[model samples]
Target chain A: MTKGTLYLIPVPLAEGAEHVSYTPFQLELIDHIKEYIVENEKTARKFLKAAGLKTPQQELRIHDYGKHVRDKVNYQELLAGALRGEDIGLMSEAGCPGVADPGAEVVFEAHKRGIKVVPLIGPSSILLALMASGFSGQNFSFIGYLPIDKGARSKKIKDLEQESQREKRTQLFIETPFRNNQLLSELLKSCKPQTRLCIACNLTAPDEYIRTQTIEKWRSETVDLHKKPCIFLLYAG
Target chain B: MTKGTLYLIPVPLAEGAEHVSYTPFQLELIDHIKEYIVENEKTARKFLKAAGLKTPQQELRIHDYGKHVRDKVNYQELLAGALRGEDIGLMSEAGCPGVADPGAEVVFEAHKRGIKVVPLIGPSSILLALMASGFSGQNFSFIGYLPIDKGARSKKIKDLEQESQREKRTQLFIETPFRNNQLLSELLKSCKPQTRLCIACNLTAPDEYIRTQTIEKWRSETVDLHKKPCIFLLYAG
Candidate 1:
């Protein structure tokens, strides 16, 4: 018997962001998937409802892969339904699954078991930030997050800046919402004066803000990034 | 007077792949724009028509940014409509604009001119490939095309493989459709037997193919990728 396919679904980056949209194909596919492996059960259920799932919430079978239970969950058990020829959906808290999220682990296991993996189209903050940054999209790197240590973070900033300059590649990274301001300040202090920096905050939201300017120019501006989801990109070339 | 917003739009990767879908918000926005800067006028018009454009095709103004005329076109002139307070869209031959395409130049100029740039949600082959590859997506680099010269290409492959192993980061790149097989063969020859490789071809299409296997396992299988659009990912970690 053939195993069921694993569908990778993406959720909105911001809650209540009405502008966040999904393709009809994605919605139709979601309607047929009653089983899921998700980062957070509550949010996933809410999203499924918003996406027009006809299946009743009580009837849905959800396997929690949330951070708190990540270590304890049996990934193979999550796919047991799929092995029995029942299609399963995999979702993250936000954005595309398996990109910069723990969802990749589930996807990795699916591939090992020879299960078909399908990634549906959806909003991705990383891709949107890179597109609007006006940086070199041809060659770019998403380094996830910087070291929390001040000294190490500063060194990483300089190293990424140097690499961007040497290779003409764009470097992208993010920080926890509350620490965004701290990261922004460190970036201004660690990067060269002429290196370009782009701060894309609240993407796809009603009050989205995206701007790219040189570090020297950014130093003169007064902006607060406290407690707002944001993606930072650097391009020295 | 405020400058008009520049919308970065995405087109389907394969022609007549009707399974490809877009957002309602995207369709609504496309209805309001009558001017576009596109890689190919023919395909752009076809996509717009299929996307439910209410305006007649003859009334729209298109700026040709196709490869044949890329060097001659004045990018500023393409944004003339936006500068004049009329929204304009930027599109590539396929996938997301400003990503691995000449659309970035236009987006860069938009930033310099303080034009608002918004990237709409849509299909992106690179992002989808990474999601389905089951490789490390927390950190990854898209190196674009490799050196076409045989020796340089092999050396670069080795270098990327080393970097992937060291950083536990996925490395993604593409080649002209015709050169895909050549690149695949080279990757198999240059990488270690344990390195993981993913071939994502004709993504989002009916016959979409995505598979990840170690170099040793791949050598035992027979597959053809002669002229198919494909993204190759390597992860030694």
Candidate 2:
């Protein structure tokens, strides 16, 4: 067995470095790591450049995970890299790694290999949205995205709505940037008038919007659906 | 219009300074506030004592929330406390202010009265559990606590399990401390053998355990049912 470690570094939900405050233990882990892996080499360089003196843009190399093929991940090669007594930081495009991103396999493999894995807290839209949604939190789930087809998506909505109403669960899901309008319209058209919806738009940003209202109210009113990316959630009594 | 600030203070899971790491910004928010509405009198004293000192025994003055009974909150009295230049820190017994707590009513009321509500980042089991579950985060649901009655609870589980399978959603829920064993047994008994289960126990603690296994494996395993405080997560693929 080789000694290795994996850092699941959570990036900010939105831009700006002020929000990336790692806990004392987490920062220490990052500072001691010998190898760094970022989603994009360019972004990794920028992060290092911002650090001024101690940051390693050159020595601590980054792996290029091109849009994550979701199939062709070189697990052994990555494991070989880890076996070289190097620690890797798996950075997601945004939010927590492995939640809606490409770090799941790496985490799973690392665990299988008995490599120590540490996840640093920074920012997460899923948790932030949940905090403000005013929904039941004892138990909740977050499915990253949904089918784009209106028919398939509508059926999914119906199922989620039934779960929310009949099971006393709060349903949470999101959509792509361009399809938000279509999804919002479908939500208004399908869900009952009394079902509660919480739309967290551009979370952790200056123009952040956390709007909660009934579907009836949303249908009667006009909201700028194009303003930002959103994590739309529904809660039914 | 009355102007006031609503602070979302993150308390520890258990009362201890080591268990909490209040950020500099959060501490600053606490220091500047003269009027704060805490959850209870003892917690108020605990906060005050912890705020200005290095430990939990220091002296600091904090206003108690008195109670959470809807009619007994005396919203007008709290408003008066705010109007008189009180920076109200809506503290909960544990975790963040909103989820699984009663600060939402105050936060909502503050929003209605045009108060500035600022939420801080701290320990939240919901976020920690979801992060480590490794379930599909794209679509998920959170149902708080389940009914204890065997018949009603079993029916609810069946409905939730069916919905999750139909929609491929992750159903999240919790149980009372003493009822965890009963719930786990019910989950294994009612849900299909192939249904995916993720149990997050003692999250964020050194004794934390998060396992994702099928219900079939769970039924035959020698799992200790004495673990009281835990979160049960179901994912039917």
Task: Please report the candidate that would top lDDT against the real structure.
Answer: 1
lDDT of 1 by residue, A49-112 (tens): 8777898899999999998998887868989998889999999988988888878778878888
Across residues A1-237, which tens digit of lDDT does each residue of candidate 2 receive?
A: 567767676665666633333344555555666566567777756654543326554677667665755467677777666766677777767777767665665665665565656555556677667666666554455766777677998998988888778756666788887778888999999999989888888876777777677899889988776747898988785
Q: Give the top-scoring candidate (DockQ).
A: 1
User: Can you tell me which runs of candidate 1 are displaced by over 4 Å?
Assistant: none
lDDT of each: 0.89, 0.68
> Which segments of model 2 are wrong by more than 4 Å?
A1-5, A17-21, A48-55, A79-87, A111-117, A138-147, A150-169, A179-196, A214-227, B14-21, B44-71, B79-87, B151-165, B179-196, B214-228
- RMSD after Cα superposition, model 1: 1.4
Docking class of 2: acceptable
Instruction: Give TM-scores of the second chain, every candidate.
Output: 0.96, 0.86
Q: Please state the interface RMSD for every predicted structure, separated by commas.
A: 1.2, 3.1
